[model samples]
Target: MRTRKSETELPRFGEAEALRLDAADPGHRHLFHVPPADGGRHPESAYLAGNSLGLQPRATRDELLADLDAWGRLGVEGHLEAERPWLPYHELLTAPAARLVGALPTETVVMNSLTVNLHLLMVSFYRPTGTRTRIVIEDSAFPSDSYAVRSQARFHGLDPDTTVVRLTPRPGEDTLRTEDVTAFLAAEGDTVALVMLGGVNYLTGELMDIPAITAAGRAAGAVVGWDLAHAAGNVPLSLHEWDVDFAAWCSYKYLNSGPGALGGVFVHERHHGEPDLPRFEGWWSTAAATRFEMTPVSRPPSTVEAWQISNPPIFSMGPVRTSLELFDSVGMPALRDRSLRLTGYLERLLDEVTADRPLTVITPRDPGRRGCQLSVRLGEGSARELTKRLRYEHGVIADAREPDVVRFAPVPLYSTYHDCWRVADALAATVGRAG
Candidate 1:
């Protein structure tokens, strides 16, 4: 039966407009494999979960196979004989990774998991002195970071609860202001030994003022570090320019290196040759030239390579190499430009959908203060339940951060304006507006 559209019904985002926008500013979606919809009118899933796990690049599988083939052909000799030699495999990643995060090649190295690298960095930087024993972190830091810092305090014979200070957002606010962080350091600087916060917060999508926070922490005599799991590839960072003391990031999220991919770390060039810094070293920690000598006493390099412990898994590093190369070819400046346009389009559609609904965008409203990820807070239904409905029912792939938040990342590398439209369209159909 034909029926007239209700006048009181909420206005829907036009599919034609979304298609028009995509035509005008076409993204590089052809280079990725977007999953088919589980259920919906469209065949392809609207993948807005890149902030959680990015879509695999079309080149990843082939490049990863080439590395595996080298091992099969050359056997033990592949270590030095392979096309891309395995002995200095990690070195292949250094320059490009440095360029991605804006650091000097000597200061950056790709290594172990995010938390493992953070622990290694803390061994050198988190030297707690008498009365200046506190370690500060964001209240909503990823659980791995919280556990890592707490254990570091306990390892040093300090009480975790008393030693680990968490910075919270102001009353009724969704994100932390730069002043909030700077003021805390100004007041409690003397008691802090380290200040480690996420460059872009995992839950809220707020891009913290990295340069300002780093400056404030250093002036207050606290060594500053960052966990860039959500920031890398999402935003362009200048770690060397910002003078961050140390930092770490996982490639599995925005870097698209697959599940539990190896992470990258940065230590300022100024601290490279400091002798008094305590580092847990192993066979690989020795300088490259001396590594072959097999001496009882190691001669560590005057570079971040000195922090490496064991020979890294060459297989894992291959995927990261492939992804970093893609970043280099495309460049962060270009990716960030597309990210702004795509994320902004999504935000506008979300505004229309959320006006009378119980949904709210918790990420900072200012485009400068966030990356491509826009996290929405559920005001009524369980986040997990709502996301499932969004997935199977509407073919929209977004992630739920447990109790309330659902993160929608309009990744510029693959996501289309049409994908963004699908998200707001899915939510409007799934969750009815409130009275």
Candidate 2:
């Protein structure tokens, strides 16, 4: 039962070190109930797939049950009379959501899923004019994002091939260099109507230089936006201070909301009151005071809420509210501090375990360039079969990408140092068998 070293000290490997690190972690891992291993053969399996879907918070059950009780008791009146009045329930998440991303309350809103929000935000931000008729995105962005942006270009009657500009990394590189992005924007920024990228690349787990890239895009006369699906809760963001034009993120990943939980969006305060900013509007987007009037003209609110298309889904929002409460209590600074150490520990362990194997960590080595997740590239091995073996043989859950990559995300909230050790051990065994 060795004690873990302090953050300033170097990390060591082995079960004793894992236990010590877990003991030192301020984040309460017990708050989450990890699923038992296959056939209840082992204790909770090493769940390291938070990059795809986070482990659920125990509080979510109570919160969702409360919402159900309100629905049963109040019937149609639940919208107004629920315990946390459904009508204004979304407002409860506004401030906390804003705080998670370093934005003003007025500049953020929790709403539809990630891609939906992206489309809505693009309607206003991507105003392809005569000369500036293209959108810029990273070539390795999440498939959904690539599809959304390409479809958006086609929706504007522009050809996706010529209108969608993809910025790729230099040859044989796994991640994009900030200088390359800045240079790309400098050269083609004027012709680009919008520069939208994943604040963190999902495939490689590369955290982009959002502020610097945003500044470069703006300086080049292009609107800048971000798909923060992987970045939002994984890293500390200053969306407001960065002067980013718009951004959207899903809650299911690092935020620990249930699968397909509602997403959040941020619009700078400067754009809130812009009367001429063209956006697709709906009933819920109208100002709260005049929302019930059913007026002929749609008077969209001046805040980010103006992007809403339908009434907030109370059931879906309940889990998000519960999860955000945990984030509010723990605070991002503390979570981030724990996250850096945990991921670093995992990186070191991976290097040690795979030293003799064909596994290579594609994620950046620099702490500043990545988040909790690490993408491991498998050479001369089937990533799909190895991923299955990790789950079936060792009870480790990680995600696999097509061809040859597997992603493991050690979420700060519930993941442990021991979880990192178990994953590494499982990976070593799996790779040995594959070889």
Which is the leading candidate under lDDT? Answer: 1
TM-score, every prediction: 0.97, 0.95
- Which 10-residue span in candidate 1 carries the lowest summed lDDT? 1-10
The lDDT per prediction is 0.93, 0.88
Q: Note the residue pairs that clash in candidate 1.
A: none
- lDDT per residue for candidate 2 within 322-388, as digits (tens), equals 9999999999999888889999999999998667677889999999899998999987667788778
- CA shift of 285, model 2, Å: 1.1
The sequence of per-residue lDDT tens digits that candidate 1 reaches over residues 388-416 is 88899889999999899999999998999
Global CA lDDT computed for model 1: 0.93
Name model 1 segments beyond 4 Å from true: 1-10
- As a TM-score, model 2 comes out at 0.95
Candidate 1: RMSD to truth: 2.4
